[model samples]
Structure formats: structure tokens, C-alpha cells
Target: MSTRTLPPPPPPAEVRCWPDREALLADRAKAMAELHRLSIGVPRLLLLWLLACGLAVGWGLVGAALKTFEESRPDALSALFGVIFACTAAGFLIPTGIVMGLGVRRDKTVRERLTQWSSLDRDPTNDARFRSPGVSLCWFVPSFLLCTLGLWLSFATPATAERGQETYADVTMLMGLGLILWLTGLLGIAKAVSHFRWAVRLVTAVPVSAGDGGHR
Candidate 1:
């Protein structure tokens, strides 16, 4: 009286049929360009600038608190202010750090998943819009200038203090601001380079035919 168990039906296969090779290439190029645009869009850039500014301000606050502690005899008001500054700095820094760490992790995971999902089929550089010089230069100039300015500020002697009168707290604030700027600029430069390289690669790459397993 035992009943036979039937196996579950196999999942249905999903297929995308393109009208022609040109249609498929156009679709792929559009997708790749869109991804590039999203990566360096204005909203993302603004967020990065805000994050850098927050870190810089947090570090400055920490420096101020440390300066108060270095005073031989800080008054009650000064000490209270120092504590407040420290607490505020911690509030800003902790959340900023967490957001940055989480963003990096999420971006990595998304990129890995995307790599597994599909691949390029044709040279996207064939499209004039995709290989526009304006796009790369717009990113490069600002990034290069920021990097240069940051380096100069980091090494230049502080004008506020005489050579022998500089305090550790002052130095800490200057260095922290400079470091954040340097890192931000470097990130921008990397993005610009990546964009340039992608354009170049696309231009030189051979277009794959749909029959040759061009996309997966």
C-alpha cells in the first residue's frame, strides 16, 4: 500500500532572443555605459564629499579636545567643553566609519555577483557617445587638482604657528585634514583612470557574434 512519489518538475529555461547582432551590441553598450554613469554620478560624488568633510570636522574636534587636555590647568568650563567636543566627534566619526565600511562591502559583493551574471559582447567604443573625451576629462582635472592641493597642504609648514611653537594638537588636525583630502582625491583619480581604461579597452576589443556565446 506504499504510494510512489513523483519528482518535482524542472525549472523553465529563460532565453533572450535579439532581433539582430546590432540590436544586441547596442543593448550591451547601453547597459555598460549606464553602469559607468551610475558609479560616478553627481549624487554619489556629493555623498563622498560630505563624508570627507564630516571626517575632517570630526578630527578637528578631537584635536580641539586634546588641546584642552594639554593645558596645564584647564578651567571647569574648558574641561566641560572638551568633553562635549570629544563626544560630538565620536558621534560623527563612528557613524561615518560604519557607513563607509558597509558601502565598500556592499559594492564588492555587487561587483562579484555582476561578474558572474553576464559579459560584454561588442566593442562599446564604436559609439561616439560612449567614448566621449569630455566625460573622462571632467573627472580627471578636478581629481588631479585636489590631489596636488592636498599634497602641498600636508607638507607645507603651518602658517598659524611659528616653527618651534607648533603643538601636537595643531599638527594632528592639519595632518588629518590633509590625509582625508589625499584619500578622496586618490579615489577620484582611480575612478577617472578606470573610466579611461574602459573606454580604451572597448575601442580596441573585438566584437563577438551572438552565435559565438558572446553573452552568458
Candidate 2:
């Protein structure tokens, strides 16, 4: 019988140590900034805006179709146009939303992996700097504004046929826009709250010796 031999096991992964705690913190900050930039770049924002527009258009078309069907003499041409517009809008919005959501998830995973590799146990000073008031304010102000504006729009009374010249279709369009704004604003608010909580935790965390930073 021939003896079977297995190849040697791979060596254990090496842990990189920073010369000091400050160096480690600096590296962490830089990495985080880069990650943020990549996650919310201008292109991504533009794409989201476009998708939002598409959704609004879709809703408007759907409302128009409803109005047409309610009419005593509904035309086949208008119905066809409405169907085309709605399908187009859905074709753009659904796939784009899915792609963007997946992209966000992937970015989050990357951030977590990087943090695990580069984090230190105890560094209050560094943590404070990372979650500075300036940074927190930047996040908070926009989120607050979005939430406020969104809520106002969402709850505003829709124009009624008895009260105004606006048709049912017009009211429906306005309501759809408000709903989109509310959802977007809600998401922003959630993100801001999460950041605030993270800052508070960092401020209150206990400190210990961050001895020669090695494999986190």
C-alpha cells in the first residue's frame, strides 16, 4: 500500500502593528473618510434623484389612467399611453432601486471588514476626534431639514374637487410626491440618529491600554 502525503498547512495570517496608537488612529480616520466618499459620491446621488423622478412620473401616469377610466367616455388611446408610461417608469425604478440597495450593502460590508482589521480597543481621544461636533453637525442639519420638509408635505391636505380647480389626477400626483419625500427623509433621519448614538457610545466607552496595536 502506498503512503498518502498531504501538503503542509498554510502559515497563520500575520498581524500588522502600528508604531504607536496615534499612527493607528490616523490610518483609521483616513480609511473611514475614503469609505464615506465612495459610498455617497455625486454619481450615486444623481442616480437616486433620477429614480425618484421616474417614480413620480409613474405615479402621475397611474393617476391619469384612473381618471380616464372613471370618465363616461374613456378613450383607448389614453389608456394605452398611460400603460406605456407606467411600465416605463416601473422598468427604470425597480431595477435601479435594487442595484443601489445592493451597492449600499456591499459598501457597508467593506466598511465593517476594514474596521475589524484596523480598530484599536481603547482610544477615547481618537474616538472623540473621529466623531467631532463639526462632522456631527454636517450630518444632523441636512437630516433635520429633510425630515421636517418631508413631514410637512406628506401631511398637507390634498386639493378637493369641491374646494379647488385641481382634478383628482393632480391631487394623486401631489400625494405620490409627498410619499416619496417622506420615505427619503425618514431614511436620512434614521442614519443621523444612528450616527448620534455611535458618537454617544464612543464618548462614554471605558478606556484601557491599547498596547502595541496588532491584529484587532
TM-score of each: 0.74, 0.64
Report each candidate's C-alpha RMSD, comma-separated, in the order given.
9.2, 9.1
**Pairs with backbone N, CA or C atoms under 3 Å apart (clashes), candidate 2:** none
What tens-digit string does per-residue lDDT give for candidate 2 at 17-43?
566656656665666545444434444
**Clash number by candidate, in order:** 0, 0
**Which runs in model 1 stand beyond 4 Å of their true positions?**
1-23, 104-119, 123-126, 158-164, 208-211
TM-score for candidate 1, residues paired by index:
0.74
lDDT of 1 by residue, 65-178 (tens): 888876734488888888998999998889987776665554444333222222435444455565556756766777788788777768773644565588877877787777
Error of 2 at 46 (Å): 6.4
Predict model 1's lDDT versus the native. 0.62
